[model samples]
Target: MTTATMSKPSVGFEKLSMRGVTRSYAKAAAPALSHLDLELARGEFVALLGPSGCGKSTALACMAGLQPLTSGSIWRDDVRLDTLPPEKRGFGMVFQNYALFPHMSVQKNVEFGLSMRRVPKAQRHERALRALKMVQLEEHAGKLPSQLSGGQQQRVAIARALAIDPEIVLMDEPLSNLDAALRIEMRTEIKRLYQERGLTVLYVTHDQEEALSLATRLVVLRKGVLEQTGTPQEVYTNPASAYVAGFMGYRNLFPAKVENTGPGDDISVVAHGTVLHGTSRAASGTANGAAVSVAIRPEDLVVAGQSTGNSIKAMAEVVEYHGRELSVQARTGPDTVLHLKTNEPVVAGAVLHLGVVPDRVLVYPADDGEETVQPHV
Candidate 1:
């Protein structure tokens, strides 16, 4: 978790907004985006997070003018973006595929945007070189796309985006094509680049850890609608709904009945006759005496013989050794699987005791379960 912030770059962060943005293909009866509303500030990195067909990419396209909105408005600062074409938006974009011009050299590809805008040849070359240097790909300037590795091609794509000196950058899972190690490396690098350049980046991805680690803010979408928006910590630690909670790495969540205590009193539930007292991270206060989802983080649960606090006795069902930690899943019931993690080893099918952290539990109304608005992170 140790991270260092990069030096700030001098790019401006123009405001971006979508007021009731809606889009639909003629074949589909309903709009892809059902009156979606979201906004991003300058010098901020925001993630579009959700599952497939959730309109996460579509929302970005509407804002980029790659696709026309059926209704609503896309605005960059005070200017209405709906009337403008893609190029007129003056935005930098890095796609999932690292769309480089194969026939062109690295420097030429980076300079293409400037060239298309009729930027001075000398200035364009200067910008291109500076951008290449930023990515540590100056030597690759003479090379073509086919000559580079996937990571190298990606760096080229980033350089091309920066060459234009655009106020904003939009990316669609740009690092997804790389290996796991490279994805982690580039995620950190991209965050540093955004901070250093003071670039306002609206990135789309389904990686929760990526969004949590890199973004200053986040927008969750489901079926073309905004489920929630907040700081990564806020969204992850305190999701607004069950769908959001489930999307944000909440593995141990199931229906529970609040007993004894009245509405919103220190909530307590029974797991195998153990009175498990815990708090739900739901924004709306939990409704006692009703069936609510009890979600807790796997890390929040500790494994020991018989520990204090709310605890559960269960048979360990599965154990995965993920290098740094042991990922354990315990069978508490026929359908209930409680996850636990430890630095020490634990055998599968061994009867063990688990301690659940009270405050880490998440509660949501059972009815709020169907929406998929975890829109791109």
Candidate 2:
């Protein structure tokens, strides 16, 4: 029956789960989370990514046993986590603010967790030194958090988390407080640390690029619902829905109306008061007489002087030159504007030709997230 017991525990015993969990605030219109089902493999990093109010951080709190789940359960490995207290959950957390004690030296901060648990004093000091070395901050062990740069403080926070040798690590937008360059640098640093330790991490962030870069499995959520979950490439290359598609880098979405179905099935869309064709399969079987939206990514757009597969004549409205590439914003006939990222340059207002590969397009039901049409099976 696989009754959630006596199962093998992977490294650090880091399995994580949320089953039918819900959270509601009395004054809010809806639950902060609804029937959420999330799973993280013992050693894999799963990123909880979404916009504000989307239940990502809430889910993390539930798993950490910091906040009570309104319903259902949370678990780590084969044990029910909601049954335990925050400390009993065997979780280590690093917040966005790098919550370290201002008065404590780096070594003391890292040893605090172990000290709380009554670890042998000698062992605690040894583990703390090792944790500081892991983050390359052993030399700063004598300095306080106030004396460190933002990045260094964050690293100390990481060292503190690692000192406990926790069953799992939960990070909530830990790099959000850093500047752009530091953020990029820390992203690589954290990736390396996680890999070296084989740590299971559940990270929460609203940064699409960050999730795309770090997650072994990325979960995209919206308005308290799970939109999609997949490997970064799979989520980006083949989104499960429009909401998820947008998060995966699609920027040029056009409203489409499905008109027919067959080998020569004709879908219809209006641009500049003119009807355009070239849609592949109607997303929904009922799309024949229904409305839908088609998504085309900026990189998938082809710019030139003639029409091609699912091509549209977009008046080059604006152009911005980025170092290695050009950014193009064009009005495709008037109703919609399409954005393209290209290495090539073309004059603005040139009415250049642009085409989207049918296979690369993502179609969504017009009503917006109420329904999803999976690609033909």
Candidate 3:
């Protein structure tokens, strides 16, 4: 959440658009990337987030022209990018492996793009130095790739990408190689660079926390399809589907039946004899007697001083200390287990009353009474 802010770009029209993009391999039964349509405004950091094999990388490859699409079109302003080669797309790409040339010095690696374009030697040298300085690696420009740490190597790769003064930067898990602390450092640096340079970026990563922290807009992908696209707050606070709810950190989801509905959005759902009252996160078509899945975050379910409306009796089965908060696994009924986060720890086997606010409850259409998004193996 320490991300720096950038002024919105002045240009109004869409800077990049991908329409009906699908990529299928010869031996595969299914497409790596299915039909997907996306638009990026002039200056926005958009994260393509999903699990592995969900086609985030394939989407990036299609956009970068590294992988051909089975059926789709890519556009930059008015030009069709699908017809052009990868180099002709004029996009700066930072790879996961920090694709630096082993034989070249950091300075030369960054200047490679300029040399490719036949830029003047003085201009290439000057621009490379500027890029290196932007990433705070100018002093290390003379060093070889093997001499630098993983974070520094990533900086060099970023500097190389930025040396061309690209309009958009495509990063594929650029910080995955670094340790946790260094990842955070590089994430802040990337955000800073985007803001300072006013560049549009499409960052691909499987880490939901990373996407939530860095992107201005998040494009959630599931099985090669676009599940949802919105600002971080919107997507996290108001997920459009059960799959999205699970992805957004909702851990306690269970099957329930809508028992009561009115002209207002308020409804009651019953799961394993536990009745929960809340505003529906479902569409207007949700009606009484309809089966639905109810979702609540572990942090939202709290121990109540007294039983309030929408309260349930649970027995603490296990408690874990998470520093600031205690993660309590409690059994609500014979078969229903709920996870709760509390400030104070509770002893195992203690009976506890838990409560949830009506506004905090989320309801969704269940796929056979369960969320379709499975936990990664």
Candidate 4:
């Protein structure tokens, strides 16, 4: 692989805006994406994150012109973008599959987009080699896709996308096919490319951790509707709704009734016959006896010592040793189970008093027909 730096692509835009973007298929019961309004600033790394069928990929496809919108418009700065064809839009795309030509050499694959654009042969060759070098795969330029590993092929796909010097790169779960270790390695490589090239990216993924670690901002969707949009820190620390809170690794979620509103966004609630205090985004005007849901992350639960602000007494039903801590599933009521983690050695059937800081607990208005939190497999 060559280490020589290539000239940066001259592409910059103030913002790319999507206004009420909606897509529907005749055979489908509902639209795949619905009324999505989003904006991407120059050089921003935005991740579209959610579970399967949450419209993340659909949104990317709509933006890439692979799928036509049912109703809505996309704009680049002041220019209307949805009116243009995919090739004419001047955007690069990487798919979940590497999507490389099996018969073509790696260099030829990287040069295909340029060739389509009628770039000169000499210029396309130089750009292809430079793009390959960017991915550290220039040495494999002559090899067919069949000869390279999954990671190398993915890199070649990335190089192919970058070779076109697109204004924005749209990635649809590009790393989902790679193994766990390769996924991490490619994440670093992609981040480096984004920072070094100052590339604007709109990425799609169902993995929460991937989005949290790589994205400058996260756009979370549910059933084709936009759920929340915020920085990773903001979303992880303070989710806008119970659905988002469950998706963000809040393992324990249960129904609670608001008891009173305290000073400064603090709220008191009663769950499973125990009183608990937590911070609420809607605490300012929350009425007493209002239905609410309480969410707490497993790592935030601690074995109670002397201080007891919010405490629950339960019997541990299952205990498993993690590398650095013990994971416990405790039963607090006939139908209530709470998951928590602690550093202390614990065994099944042991009585444990779990406590959580008020700030760590999140309270949201109760949602009807909300899905339970499922462990990510």
Candidate 5:
């Protein structure tokens, strides 16, 4: 059987690309990665995103040549990358643990790669200091990693990666170990470096917000399979499937049937004896009575005073006070619970009239057997 592949728009020079890449452990029934095809253009910040164990790290490892693919090939333009070893691939790597030698000073750690390559000591020292300056750590060059804070240590790691002047940089959750404040600080630093140096970066992260904020494009995976690939706006505003919509933080998902579809793209769906009308974003026609899944974000549901023919009457069950908004849990129907976000404060045990904007609802073809829904708060 032929393998399935995903293609990207070739706007610039293609720096790294993978085709039908799969990695399977011994005796494991399923592969860690399955026929995944992806590409990275020159200077693009691409984020490999998914939940834990979804093969984000494995994919990054394969790209760095740390782990060989069980099948398929990786390429840098016409050059096959699978034939090279990790050291020979010339791709810089930043780890979550900040892999720096404690015994070595920050400058020495940054210059280690150059020293290993047998470069002249003078040139190595110069490049190391340059990298340190780039990360704004030149003053800390004499200090050891243990002397610096977590954020500073991460900067040293980044400087070390940049010291080699590699064509590509691969990061495996580099900010996962840092505290909330430091993570935000490092995120800005990384973006600054990306802009200043124009590095082609492939970052692996489980944090959807991180990927959405940092990446030029996002490749989302689930169960080792490619769910969707698009820019943050494209994926967040228009998820292609229920799985992707859930992953992107859509809390309201329901199983329904297509009761009718109007010529102007208006769609009517029914669930548990409740009929809802909305507009369909999909261009493909759906036959009447076809089973489908409808997804909506909590923020998209507006709280109104009365039912506007398309509105539903829901009683508030719980109210969570966020700094800027309130998260209200309400029961809309006998079997349906809806989560809505509003700037207005809502008290528990109060009744709320909710209306969903027609164009905001997304409808997808239903899965055949079991349906999986991930609700995020």
Candidate 6:
């Protein structure tokens, strides 16, 4: 079914803002969410990304009214939304699990919310069918959730959320239950829905790649604190901190001391008794002798040919075939390991010279309190 024919939800809003949103559990040392200030403009797709227990899910729950905030407020334009009940918030939520009734047919599951609101039978049925059609699940409307494949069940869950005609869709790891292939397919489907319907989405997930692929903007969290907010490209290419760099797939992190500050955010650092040059991500560039963490992604670390720019001489420890490229883990120091991808066939124990461009190496202050010298697998 074409999106043009599908029913549009009344989701337009100037902004939905979360101001100083904080949630805490009893006996917990820290709040699940801490002074999180976030905003969603009309039709914005924002992904809440972090590791487990980082409170990405908690943030979504607080916004959805499933969890009451310990402090702060939620606003939908001029209206204060935190005081309202979940049903009155006009937000639809898709869960990590399908969350469908085993005994109910797909159509019935989709119509449940409308029925609770006392919509007339015929109108609710029509809306249910339209929502099902939006997810391309109209043909399975009569089948029970138990009789469907995992992907089909997830589609039904999505249809159920849409049937409510919500002002915003709150999804908490909606595709985590599916297989890798299904997750990719559903990611595309969700992206299409957001674009075609101009959806206001607040999605939560721990997978950086999933968030990067689907979100227009990303909100990264660490230990329940909002770490950074930016476009996917901004967060991926230039992470704000060492913690963010680690999460964004910087497999190699080195403890370095600033050697000299060069022109235009370029600086040299002494890491493992070797001088390496990189771009400083810190707002105020590092000074000489200041401790810092240097981060580089595996793909950015290439086999050195001749130029001698930021080159590291290492012995390959492990080599894994990845079809088009090889994944190599190499040891550069007594306790330092670096991971890199290369097209060249590298044998274990082979000596290799790996180099990285200055722009690709990100430098963050070690005092960020999250620096790790070890390679991240």
The numbered model that scores best in TM-score is 6
Error of 2 at 256 (Å): 2.1
Candidate 1 lDDT, tens digit per residue, 1-377? 12233234454445788999989889986678999988888888999988777888898888778898889998877889899999888889988788899999999999999898899999898889888876668889999999999888988898798788777889988887777886777787787777666788899988888888899998988778898999999998888877787689876666777653435635676545577787654455555577766777778888877756778888888999889999998897787778778876789878888887677765566655464333232
TM-score of each: 0.88, 0.85, 0.88, 0.90, 0.86, 0.91
lDDT by residue (tens digit), candidate 2, 123-159: 8888888877766688999998999998788878877
Error of 1 at 372 (Å): 7.1
Taken over the whole model, the C-alpha lDDT of each candidate is 0.79, 0.75, 0.84, 0.87, 0.82, 0.86
lDDT by residue for model 4 over 1-377, one digit each (tens)? 23345455686579999999999989999889889999999999999988888899999989989899899999999988899999888889998788899999999999999999999999999999988887778899999999998878888898899888776899988887677886887788777777877888999987788898889999989889998999999998888888888888888999899999888789999986788999886635689999988999998989875437698888899998889998899999899999998998888998888889899888888877768544243
Report the candidate with higher lDDT, 2 versus 3.
Answer: 3
lDDT (10s digit) by residue, model 6, range 59-161: 9989989999999999999999999999889888898788899999999999999998899999899999988876678998899999999878888888888
Per-residue CA lDDT of model 5 for 155-180, tens digit only, reads 78887887876667899988877788
Best lDDT among the predictions, by candidate number: 4
Judge candidate 4 at residue 310 and give its lDDT: 90
Candidate 3, poorest ten consecutive residues by summed lDDT: 1-10
The list of candidate 3 runs beyond 4 A from truth reads 1-14, 133-140, 147-151, 333-335, 368-371, 374-377
Off by over 4 Å in 2: 1-14, 120-126, 133-139, 263-283, 333-335, 369-377
RMSD of each: 3.6, 6.4, 3.5, 2.6, 6.7, 2.6
| Distance from true location, Cα of 263 in model 5, Å | 2.3
- In candidate 4, how many Å is residue 319 off? 3.1
lDDT (10s digit) by residue, model 3, range 122-226: 989988988788667889989999999988898789889878877788999988877888678778877777878788999998778888888999999987889
